[model samples]
Target: MFNATECIEIQVKSRHALDGRLEAAVKDLQETAMRSRTCGILITRHQPGHYTAELSDQVPFGITRELCR
Candidate 1:
């Protein structure tokens, strides 16, 4: 039983083309979701250096997918 409106979304940005920060951000988001008892995480790449991580019941737990804009 989860509320879609209660979903959590986080934005991440990196200047370098290849950086570990983006992955780290997703990991951090996962940990936060675990701590909060939330299920599922979505990663969306808006551009080369921008991304968004979302926690929502719409996605299955332990699954990650890229959303197209």
Candidate 2:
């Protein structure tokens, strides 16, 4: 848990393994992206006094290729 004013950074302790038996994942949503077998970590940032957060899922790539450099 984090406080409103906290400046926090999180690192993925492990690479999430893909579960073929897991439910289908949506390639479009950040949440779904987070749940992706390829995803590494989900991150969030918040402002002080207000725990409003920004969440991001890191896919870093699609089937054929990742986003262009």
Candidate 3:
């Protein structure tokens, strides 16, 4: 089983700067969640390949007006 929670993440890609990019993504994800009405539980992860984004089951992506704020 997997742990579930609410979240929204913003991810960016970097070729030579993996650590830096992950760090930035974590910060960006927090900032993105903080500025909105979200509960601010975004989980940021860095992979060996392309960067990616995700929203949890409790916060699935869709037409949520508050998500923009």
- TM-scores vs. true structure, each candidate: 0.59, 0.19, 0.38
The candidate that wins on lDDT is 1
Whole-model Cα lDDT per candidate? 0.61, 0.27, 0.42
Instruction: List model 3 lDDT by residue over 1-69, tens digit each.
Output: 122343334344555575675456555555555455343333434444444333334553332122221
> Candidate 2: misplaced stretches above 4 Å?
1-35, 49-69
Rank candidates by TM-score, best first.
1, 3, 2
Q: How does candidate 1 fare on TM-score? A: 0.59
How high a TM-score does candidate 2 get? 0.19
**Please, what's the RMSD in Å of model 2?**
12.9
Q: What TM-score does structure 3 among the candidates reach?
A: 0.38
Tens digits of lDDT, candidate 2, 1-69:
212232223232223422211111222233433444353222232322222112223324232122211
Superposed on all Cα atoms, model 3 deviates from the true structure by an RMSD in Å of 11.2
Q: Please, what are the lDDT tens digits per residue for candidate 1 over residues 1-69?
A: 434444334444545632465566567667766765657777676666566666766677777777866
